[model samples]
Target: MEYFQHEWLERNLNWFEGVSKLIPSTNNALESFNRVIKDENTLRERLPLSRVVVVLINTWSLQYTANAKTVHAVPTLNLGLWTKAYQWATEKKKKIVSHVNSEGYVYFIPAGQSNEVTDLEETLNASFSTFEEFKTVAFSIWTTTIPNDSNKWIEGTCNCPGFFKKLICKHVVGIAIRLKYANPPAEAKSVPIGAKRRRGRPSKARQALLVQ
Candidate 1:
């Protein structure tokens, strides 16, 4: 146990402790974006650099225009873990209400010491304004570990025993929820309205209509 704590856990898991909530903990979003790019007809096979550039530019331009139209709207959270984490936080809110009221934060009890309840870490706490304060609660739990190089929680160290066994815990969910609300990625650049059209020959359908 000591070896695991000092040699492996301490060395790897703590790297992004503080900043993990500020950015995505997984590369799923980037992977989805790459998938979209590859799905495009222009990118499905090997192509010349010039053709790839044209396709990329056209795709990006269209995306920029679409994003600009909805830039002010609230974005939805679609990550599966985030939804589960928010639900867990909700279920546990009543159990932690008194601590939150007295200490001004939620306490993280170690898995082995779940029943003792008194020796709480002063610095490690979760904060939320209301039962619906999902992001705040999640941030508090996610940033509990000391910052180190691994920047992830692969095992359980909290009162949530599932974590140590390398399962998802509510605390992790909370962090994911917080990240979903707090540090959304930047929107694509907006294209100007009324931009000049790209020059191209009329389409075959249009040519047929003209001939008719």
Candidate 2:
């Protein structure tokens, strides 16, 4: 258990808090692309080492990169983030402690609300489906700053983990909404707040695999 925690659960593998190391906890992107190559180009066949290299070097990589990824004509707000901003703004529950300093308008946002995971026993017992869900219950007080010119709320820096990873957080967005600096799109209101990743592996039939 100690070995696993130090190796896999720590920064070398999983970024639990991930403040400085703003990277994903899982190597899902590389693993997903590996699946694509194995199933599509290799035809799920155990080829000779030389043959595999030839296919990868001659065909797979070139074919995959033939087309560029989709590029939006204009920069757009992430739907999920917009949804969270809307939810935080609409709820109007959490109290924001604000004051003016030499730098900017400093707001101390209490991120933790009364929720589950009261004790270590309860935390251990709970079957959290995903890391995101497990981490949804935050207890930290995020220090957020919006410049004197409220129009620059988007430039706010937040001490929260979300801001560190994505360069934006609910605290900044919530304050921006309150200060009339930004607004969530209309679609945000309809988005389901409690959405979670589908539990368990997808059915084999749904999974893309080449079978001889």
Candidate 3:
């Protein structure tokens, strides 16, 4: 634990908060000084211990002399990046489900029907023999996205942020849901959202944004 703490300190010396016994003992400041001195010449890089010590003192002197000057730190990024990630993942849910196969290849049918269901197969598959099974699988998969110590889904890595900065990771899951419906082996069906399948009205905020 002490060694790990020391390594952490070395890596983040510039960002140090305060002096505490709990903090690791690592002289990264000295090491950085050494690097600066040796940077100019190959022979100096291999300098003897006496020369190295002199070089270090010079580096520290330079740093202290320049201390009064102000330097800008990196600017804070927008908090909207997180919000955008959530929205993107939610919207892309439908696309990810379109690519699973029985072998977990590029294609697989959802559990239902009698036709051959490919990953891109337009039909929904019903793998479970009964509604109870379908419910169990859907609920189980859904819960995986809830955050936990294991990072089941909510906090773990999903390619959403990497693909598009704010994309929600649900595209793959959405595609999977559709694939479940596409399964031709059983009699599964795509149930529409009870409210309505078509867009009926825009939210007030959306209308306002459009007007702007």
TM-score of each: 0.38, 0.47, 0.20
Off by over 4 Å in 2: 1-16, 19-21, 48-50, 57-66, 70-81, 98-107, 114-138, 143-183, 190-212
lDDT of 1 by residue, 1-212 (tens): 55555664477776633323333456776797778777864556878889878997787778788884234222233333333445544443323312333212334433332333332454245443444464333433322231122233222123333343333455654543343422322220111222322344323352335554
* Lowest-sum lDDT 10-residue window in model 3: 182-191
For model 2, where is the 10-residue window of minimal lDDT? 67-76
Q: What is the number of residue pairs that collide in model 2?
A: 0
Residue pairs that clash (backbone atoms under 3 angstroms), model 2: none
- Candidate 3 similarity to native, TM-score: 0.20
Write model 2 residue lDDT over 1-212, tens digit each, in one string. 45544675674763345444334445775798789778877888888999988888777556648843343332235766777777776665566667799879987666566322234335435555555655553443566787888766777777776776566777777778877888776666655555532444323354568999
Ranking by lDDT: 2, 1, 3
Best by lDDT: 2
| Native-referenced Cα lDDT, model 3 | 0.35
> Per-residue lDDT for 1-212 in model 3, tens only?
45434565465565532233123245674696466566743245566778767765676557668894334232122223223333333342232232323323232223322233233322234355555665544322211122223212222222222212222233333333333421111111121222222333323352345654
By TM-score, who's the top model here? 2
Scored against the true structure, residue 118 in model 3 reaches a CA lDDT of 38
